[model samples]
Target chain A: MGRLLERLDKVDRRVIYILMAASVIVPLALKLDFPIPIGSGPSMDLYMAIDTLPPGSTVIISFDYDPSTKAELQPMAVALTRHLFGHGVRVIGMAMWPQGASLGQQAMAQAADSLGAEQYEDWVNLGYTVGAGVSLLRMGSSIEAVYPQDRDGVPYDSIPLMRDVRRLGDVDLAISLSAGDPGIHSWVMMAKDTYGVPVGGGCTAVSAPEFYTYLGTGQLVGLLGGLRGAADYETILRERIPGAPGGLATPGMAAQSISHLVIMGFIVIGNVAFIAGRSKRKGGAK
Target chain B: MTMEIVGIWLGALLTLALYSFLYRDNPFYKFTEHLFVGMSAGYWVIYNIYNVLIPNLWDRLVGTGDAAPDMMMIIPAVLGLFMLARLVPKGAGLSRISLAMIVGTGAGLSLVTTFRTNCLSQVEGTIIALTGAGTGQFLSNLILVVGVVCGLVYFFFSKPHRGVIGGAANTGITVLMVAFGASFGYTVMARISLLIGQVQFLLFEWLPTIPIFRGLTG
Candidate 1:
């Protein structure tokens, strides 16, 4: 076992790094699409939530991620907005993270263009709120106190979009695509629980399980987790939009599958080595 | 094929380069890390100013006159600028004005909202119907409530105890630890999974078509 350890320890880590990188990259390049048997409960609930909304019902979405998660969460945000506006829902968007507003704008604009949804008429952006969770919590009742003006700082009263909107009760639903602190938990704690609005969310995979307890109790109507969640949300979108390019989900899933298989293989090989070395050491001692 | 293959190879190399840090700190990891940070920072600054500050703040306060005056914009606009005062040494006192506006309002907001939402409603959500239809729902909500209560108690950093309350607090600590451990495990898996995707993209997709790695495929 000591000899085995010595030998294995000498093996170059660069080789492993190289091997793992190949495991992720190749599958994505092939445009491999392997759909894991995902439960439709969450996906379907999300679809129906947006589908069932009254036409032009006011809804709010907060983009709570920065560029680090842009690769995974952005696509889901686009698809959800597309689904929301598709139902003729009037939308107002906000951001918690400073970098979030741009991505939010770009996504809403794209989804709006695709659906021929007019901005400020059907939707408007409030931009990044400086105070994070506090902004939403307070703005629920008096929207003007938090944002005296629209995104361009035009007086809130003057903007056609803000004219009739006041308080959390006016918003039919709230959704957040979150990364971490000041994200889903904040909205769940503030908007839904405090203000009595229904909430739904999407988050990175690592952040999903803590939320499952929320899901189980129905704090959040449904949730999409990590890259898998994003891909699943995209699948629902493709089915709805017919022939819409599914973006990164297809490649993302393929890359994920290949990565999993590779990691599993390494674990198997490692166990074999452990067993073999144990017997060999016993023989040497004997 | 050419463009697609090239992208795969680049992504794969970056994945490998990033993973190099796990072995030990090295130039490969540093290069990729810096590039990622730099790109993300550049993207963030541009977006913050152009999309957020410009549309949300600057354009509103000092309009180009292309748009008419928004007289009410001056208030929040000045408050927002005070936030930048935190960077100056002498003027750092001015930053407190920003901090007060942000923190005081935030605290007030959370105090009212947190009680009703996090405390009261969660307590209500804690109720469960241990019977036919909502059985699983009931059980899950029960666990969630217990977890959240014990979890919050565990985080209390004040006096340690020796009685029944102490025992409960200790148990709460255990629950939080287990939860944290599970979170860590999930994070490791997600990162490893991401790394694996990069490698697969490189080999199967990139190598098969690229001039440099085409030989490896053959």
Candidate 2:
């Protein structure tokens, strides 16, 4: 015990970092899997939110995330889009992040292609915009004000999916996959509150807890929290959306669980060393 | 053969390079970090300028190569330009124009929506099922409301406290600490999950695939 404590006390930060990195990498490489005891509230809410939407309903998936977020947020975005398409939902894709326009369009395009969805008829891309939160407010008043045209520079009226959608009120659901300030909170304040449209979100794990308050307030019907939420969402998708090729969620959960164990391990070691050092000093004093 | 596998392989390598920084501050991590930042920023700027600024605002200004643009684009362009004026020493006053435009637009939205979303909805949520006030949710809410009130009171250190006020204040601290610990646990889980995600990509995506990577391992 004394020897283990002594080693733990002097263990270099580099060693700790290496262990953490391995903790993360090994599970991913070996495909280490773990049990996912679903937290019912957010997971169930997310499942119900998309499932309840009327088939062929023109649902909007706001890919408010960027590449920085693709890891955590993308699976949910893809899963939900798949779910929407599987149920024959007419979907329009858009992004708040400037880079997100292409990323969103690309993600939707890939999913659409994979799912036998045709563009313009099945879906369209509203693409990126400036002004962020303010732009969302403008969307509440008039989506056409901020986005007069789709990504192709054709007017919103020209796109079949966009034809009747002049404001957020025209949409059945507004789902924003967000990472930061200009993401979910922006939509909640702008489109949902102003236009009275139903809204839900998927945010990065760091930002997820702050939004439980919103869920409680009913400002958001559901929130997909970070990667775990994404993984959970994928499970819902595979079950709900028939013939959806799945990899993301199960593999993702494997990674998440391993990392948690790694961190817990380090924290335990750190505490033990601290206690041991204190005891050693006390013995010397005696 | 699969683009999916290719994407995963590259992601795994990048994850390794990034996580390697935990060992020491080295050129590898810095190189990867800078590369990621640069690529992300470049991708963002190009998409925004082309998709957002040019088509939405500029096409309306410079004409769509057919008819002259209407006067509507002028105000926004000018407002955008005024934002740049802050860089000029003598024209620092122009920043106020940009500030006001942004602030006015933001404040206008915030005023209406904050009330609708935060205040009104939160108030409504706090009120339990009036049909069945004896439920568990109602009891939980009663405890919460007390916690919220007493917690707020604890922060009000204007005057000295004695008796019930002080005792309640102490109880509020205990409540806050417990809540904080739960929140901390959740956050710790979330972060560790991120670490896990990166590693997962490295192992499953990169190691078994990618010719050069596979050869090196073999």
Best by TM-score: 2
Candidate 2 runs further than 4 Å off? A240-243, A279-286, B1-16, B65-68, B129-135, B159-162, B212-218
Candidate achieving the largest DockQ: 2
RMSD to the true structure for each prediction, in A, is 5.9, 3.2
Query: lDDT by residue for model 1 over A153-231, one digit each (tens)?
Result: 5666766766778887788888898988779999888788777889999887788877876776678988887777777
Residue range A200-221, candidate 2, lDDT tens digits: 8988877887788788878898
Query: What TM-score fits each model?
Result: 0.72, 0.89
Report the C-alpha lDDT of model 1 over B104-151, residue by residue, as the tens digit: 977776787668755565567666554565767667656666666677
So what's the TM-score on candidate 1?
Answer: 0.72
Evaluate residue A212 in candidate 1 and report its C-alpha lDDT on the 0 to 100 scale. 70
Q: Residue A183 error for model 2, in Å?
A: 1.2
Q: After superposition, how far is residue A37 of candidate 2 from its true place, in Å?
A: 3.2
Give interface RMSD, every candidate, in order.
3.8, 2.6
Evaluate residue A70 in candidate 1 and report its C-alpha lDDT on the 0 to 100 scale. Answer: 71
Chain B TM, per prediction: 0.68, 0.82
Model 2 lDDT per residue over B1-218, tens place: 68877777667767778867776778888988999999877976776678777887788888775649868889888888888898997988988988997888778768877787777877777665434666776777777777767776777787565677887788789878877876676676567656555554555456668566774432
